[model samples]
Structures are given as structure tokens and as C-alpha cells.
Target: MHIVVCIKQVPDSAQIRVHPVTNTIMRQGVPAIVNPYDLFALEEALRLKDKFGGKVTMLCMGPPQAEDALKKCISFGADDAVLVTDRSFAGADTLATSYALAAAIRQIGKEQKVDIVFTGKQTIDGDTAQVGPGIAKRLGLQLLTYVSRIADLDLEKDTITVERRAEGGVQVLQTAVPCLITMLEGTNEMRFAPLENMIHAARYPVRKWNKEAAGIEDVTKIGLKGSPTVVSKVFGPTPRAEKALMQSVEDATPRDVSLNVIQKIFTQHPTLERDILAKASV
Candidate 1:
């Protein structure tokens, strides 16, 4: 019942800034924190560990500074932490990242059998929600996304059940061991690290691995070379010159105000009325 949880160190979105000239993110002054969404995945894994008495390993692919993020997970009860960092992995897109992470997981599997892999639904910076599924695809693991709850687990039978969040409701799913799960945020809260664990995390020797150590066999499948997706530019949304129209209902009855707003909308967008009528008739 060994679980591996993937996390990333990302810039605080509230404090992040974009360079006007280069149209790139300015990370120089921004504080890096563990991806908030990943915390949910970590908490879920920790909860399982508490219930089943297994090991939780924290894995991250980033610069040397990302060791801090792994250490934080250690304080939260992860048994081991591994950092996969290399210059060759720089500028990796989600595809390349998944490739590298999959390689690292393979290496970790050699040390210990991994029953489950956990990740956040999406990272705040990327927000693509692709890496977890990509890793699952590369590793041929059962991929479950947007998981809201873990309903049951049977170690002897190697079966697990979960509730997945979907369009309008939750979907109950059952899968076997060696599966990948992307946990939905707000499903669980991270626990506070006790003093002993905090001390242990501070002294923990987090293992660092380069591309070679991470079991990456192909040089052409990592970093900028392997990244096919190109970002042409990154810029903030343009500000609209017009302000929002404010309608006052203080002097009018609710029905009268509703009718007035409806009339205005119909007058401004004549086709909207026809579209609504058409849909209603169907």
C-alpha cells in the first residue's frame, strides 16, 4: 500500500507579476509555495496512510529549491521525499514533464512497489489538468480524475472505490491497484505538522536525482527539445473601456424591474429573444 504523491512548487498567484516587455512571468520577487491543489492530494494520501499503515513518498520535479516543498510534505507525514532536477528538464511542457516523472516513478518502483499514485486535479500555474493523466497513460495505470472521495479499499483484493466529480453529479468508480488519481480540491484539509515531525523534516535528507539517476533513457524526450507546445506570448486580459450598467430597483416594483431589464436585453440583442423562445419550445 505504498503511495506516491506528486507536488510542485509554484509562485504565489496573488503576488505573481508579468513582465510587460517580455510578456513573461516575473518570478524574481515572487514567493514560491507548494501548489495549493496538490495539498488536497497529499492530505488524501496521508489519510490513507493513517488508515492502512503504509508509506507515503513525496515526489517533485523542479529546481533545487523544490526540495523545500518536499520537506514540507515530510513534515506532514510523508515517509520519504525525492527531488528530480536537471538542467535537461528545464522548460519542459506537460508531456515532457510526465515523461520525466514516469521515469522517476519507475526508478522509485524498483526500490519499493507503488500501489497508488496521487496528484492534484490541476496546478494553478499550468491549469491544464493534463500531467496526471499523461503520467498514467505513459505508465499504463488506471487514470481517475476529479476524485471527490475514497469510498473503500481492500488490500487483499487489490480493489479501490471512489466518487468522481462530473458535469452535474458524482460518479462512483471501482478500480484495481497500481492506479493514478487526480484529487479534487476541497475534499480534504492538510494536517498540521507536530513538533517532532517538524524537527525530523528539517533534518531529513531528501534524495536528489538528475535525469540519468531518474532512469530517463532518451535524451531527446526531455526538457525544451521534447516540448512541442510553444507559448507565443503571455499577457494580461485587456481592460474594457465601458463600465458595467447598473440598474436601480429602489423606485420600482420587482416585476416592473424584471420586465424593464428583459426589454432592455431584448432591444440590445434581438436574436437572444428568438434563441430563448426556440429553446423553450423544444
Candidate 2:
């Protein structure tokens, strides 16, 4: 079982700031961390590799600085890491990003037959949730998104079963090998790296491929040219002027305080009483 896990290095959203004049993200001072959702995919891939005794390759398409994120994956027991970086890949949207990734995966498949590809449901910076499906379309791979659990794998039969998180409940679906899976968040916990693996990861030389080296032949199919969507503006949510009113019940009993709080809420939102009554009647 050869598994490829796609990951991204994203700015820590908690530290992100919006520029006052340009209304753009101020990434200058923000720290870069691996996307949290991708961690779940990586952990799931690692678990499969551990059980199957196969290789797990970490792949990422980002700037040169993104190699740091791939190194983190190496520390977690991934057998190899590949970083696809080039200036032409700048300002790429989901379509171009998926195209480049699919080409690179084809290159990786040349060296070792790839059985599965794993990705996060979405990237925090983009949050479009289109890249995984795009890659599947480009590669003609069966796509399973929002996967909550990998139930079974039959390497001998070349099939896999997974529990997908759907609206209201879970869906159990089976698919063949050479498929793409977008893991759901909170599906699994990331494992801690051992001291030996950490030391090796610190010294590991990750493979870096340029646009041409990664098998991108069409110049127009990558980078800003291939990206049709453009971000016209980025703005933060406006701050509300009024603050919430604090209700104190130091002298009242718990029951009285609860009633008072409920009354206050109903008074603030006049429709709440009617809404509650409607639900109760139903």
C-alpha cells in the first residue's frame, strides 16, 4: 500500500491581521503551521501505513518555505517527502493547484505504484473544499469526501470500505483502490514523533521539484494564468458597538435567576417566545 498525503503550510489564523488600507491579509508577522485538517489526513495515512507495512509519502505544493511543513510530516514516520515549489505556482486557485498536484502524483506513481491519496476536506486559508475533488477529476480517481472512518481495506481484492459523514448520519460506502480520500476533521489524533524519528527528520533532505521538474508542461495551466478566480477584496468582520448585558443573581435563588434570565432573553428577542412555543407544539 503506497499512500500519498497532501498537506499545506498555512498562516496561524489566530495571529492573522488585516491590512488597514489594502484590506488584505498581513502575513508578514504570522507564524506558519501545517493546516489542522491536513493533520487528520496525515495521521490516518500513517495509521494505514503502520498496519499495512507500506510507505507513506508526504506531498505539498507551496512556496519554498513550505518545506518546513513537509519536514514535520517526516518526523511523524512518513517514508518520504516532496515539495513542489516554483514562482510560477504563485496565486494559484484550487483548479491550478489540483492540476499541479495531480501531475506530481503521476510522477510519484512512476517510481512507486500509488494505491491511495489522502487530503483534508478543505484548507483553512481557502476553505473552498474544491481541490480534493478537482484532483480526483483530473486523475480519474474515485473520490470519497468527508470520510470519518476507514472501516476496512482488502489489498488482495483492491477494495476499501469507509464510513462517510453525511447530512444527519453516516454513510458506509465501498470503493476500489487508487482512490482519493478527503478526511473529515476530528477523525483521528496526530501521533507524537519518537526521538529517533525526530532526529532523522531534522537531518532529512526533502526532495524539491520545480514546475517543469514536477511534470508541468503547459505554462498556462498553472499559476495565476490557470486560476480563474481572483480575490477582489478581503475584509474582516465589523465590530459591534454594543456589548452584552450581564445579569447578576447574587441575592436570588437559582430557580428565580433562571426565570429572570429567560425572561430577559425573551424580552431582548421578541420572537423567541413564539419560536419556543411553535417547537413545543410540533
Candidate 3:
């Protein structure tokens, strides 16, 4: 029942700023923090470890600074932490990232049989929601996304049931071991690290793996060369020149205000009323 939880260190989006001239993200003064969504995944994994009494490993692929993020997970009670960092893995998109991470997971599997892999539903910076599924496809593991809860687990039978949040309701699905799950945010809260754990995390020797160590043989399959998606440009939304028109309800009755709003809408968009009537007739 060994669980591997993947996390990423990302810039605090609240403090992120865009360059005025280049329109690129200004990361110079921004503080880095663990991806919020990944915290839920970590907490869920920790919960399972508390119940099942198995090891939980934290994995991340980023620059050397990302080791801090792994240490943070260690303080939260993960048994081990692995940092896969190499210059060759720089500028990787979701595809290349998944390839590197999948390769690294294969290497980790050699040391210990990984029963389950957990990740966040999406990264805040990218928000593509593709890496988890990509890793699952690359590793041929069962894919579960938007998981709200772990309903049941039977170690003897190698079966696990989970509650997945779907469009309208939750779907309870069971799958075998060696599966990948992308946990939905707000499903669980991260626990506070005890003083001993914090001290241990600070002194823990985080295992560092480069591309060669992470089992990446093909140089072309990682980093920028493997990334197919290209951003043509990045720009902020155009600012509106006119301010919104304000309706004063202080001097008007509710009925009068309602009529005034509808009248204004029709007045501004002359064809809106006609279009509504036309659609209603159909």
C-alpha cells in the first residue's frame, strides 16, 4: 500500500504580475508555494497512510528549489521525498513533464512497488488538467480524475473504490491497484506538522535525481523538444473605457427599478427584444 503523491511548487498567483511591456509573467518578486490543489491530494494520501499503515512518498519535478516543496510534504508526514531536477527538463510543457515524471515513477517502482499515484486535478499556473491523465496513459495505469473521496480499499483483493465528482453527481467506481488519481480540491484539509516532524523535515536528506537517474534515456522525449504546444503570444485583457451605468434604488420602488432595468436593456440592444420574441415564438 505504498502511495506516491506528486506535487509542484508554483508562484503565488495572488502576487503574480505581468510585465508591462513584454506581457510575460513577472516572477521576480513573487513567492513560491506548494500548489494548493496538490495539498488536498497530499492530505488524502496522508489520511490513507494513517489508516492503512503504509509508506507515502512525495515526488516533484522542478528546479532544485523545488526540494523545499518536497520537504514541506515530508513535514506533513510523508515517509520519503524525491526531487527530479535537471537542466534538460527545463521548459517542459505538460506532455514533456508527464514523460519525465512517468519515467521517474518507473524508477521509483524498481525500489518499491507503488500501489497508487495521486496528483491534483490541475495546476493553478497551467490549469490544463492534463498531466495526471498523461502520466496514467504513459504508465498504462488506471486513470481516475476529480476524485472526491476514497470510499473503500481491500489490500488482499487489490481493489479500491472511490467517489468521483461528475457533472451532476458523484460516481462510485472501483479499480485495481497501481492506479493514478487526480484529487479534486476542497475534498480534504492538510494537517499541521508537529514540531518533531518539522525538525525531521528540515534535516531530511532529500533524494535528488537527474535525468539519467530518473530513467530518462531519450533526450528528445523531454524538455522543449517534446513539447508540441506553443504559445504565440500572451497579453492581458483590454480595459473597458466606459464605467458601468449605476441604477439608484434609493429613490425608486422595486417594481419601478425592475421596469427601468428592462427598459434600459431593450434601449441599448434594440434587436434583443425582437430576438427574444422570435425565439419564444419557435
Which candidate number has the best TM-score? 3
The numbered model that scores best in lDDT is: 1
lDDT per residue, candidate 2, 165-204, as tens digits?
Answer: 9999999999999999999999899999999998999998
Clashing pairs in 3: none
Residue 19 of model 2 has an lDDT of 87
Prediction 3 TM-score vs. true = 0.87
- Per-model CA lDDT versus the true structure: 0.95, 0.93, 0.93
Give per-residue lDDT, candidate 1, residue 201.
Answer: 99
In order, what is each prediction's RMSD in angstroms?
A: 4.7, 4.1, 4.3
Question: Which residue window of length 10 is worst by lDDT in model 3?
Answer: 231-240
Model 2 off-target regions past 4 Å?
Answer: 20-22, 237-282
**At residue 279, what lDDT does model 1 achieve?**
100
Candidate 3 runs further than 4 Å off: 239-266, 270-282
Shift in Å, residue 35, candidate 3: 0.4
Candidate 1 local distance difference test against the native: 0.95
lDDT tens digits, residue span 1-51, model 3: 799999999999989988887878888989899999999999999999999
TM-score for each model: 0.85, 0.86, 0.87
lDDT of 1 by residue, 172-222 (tens): 999998899999999998999999999999999999999999999998999
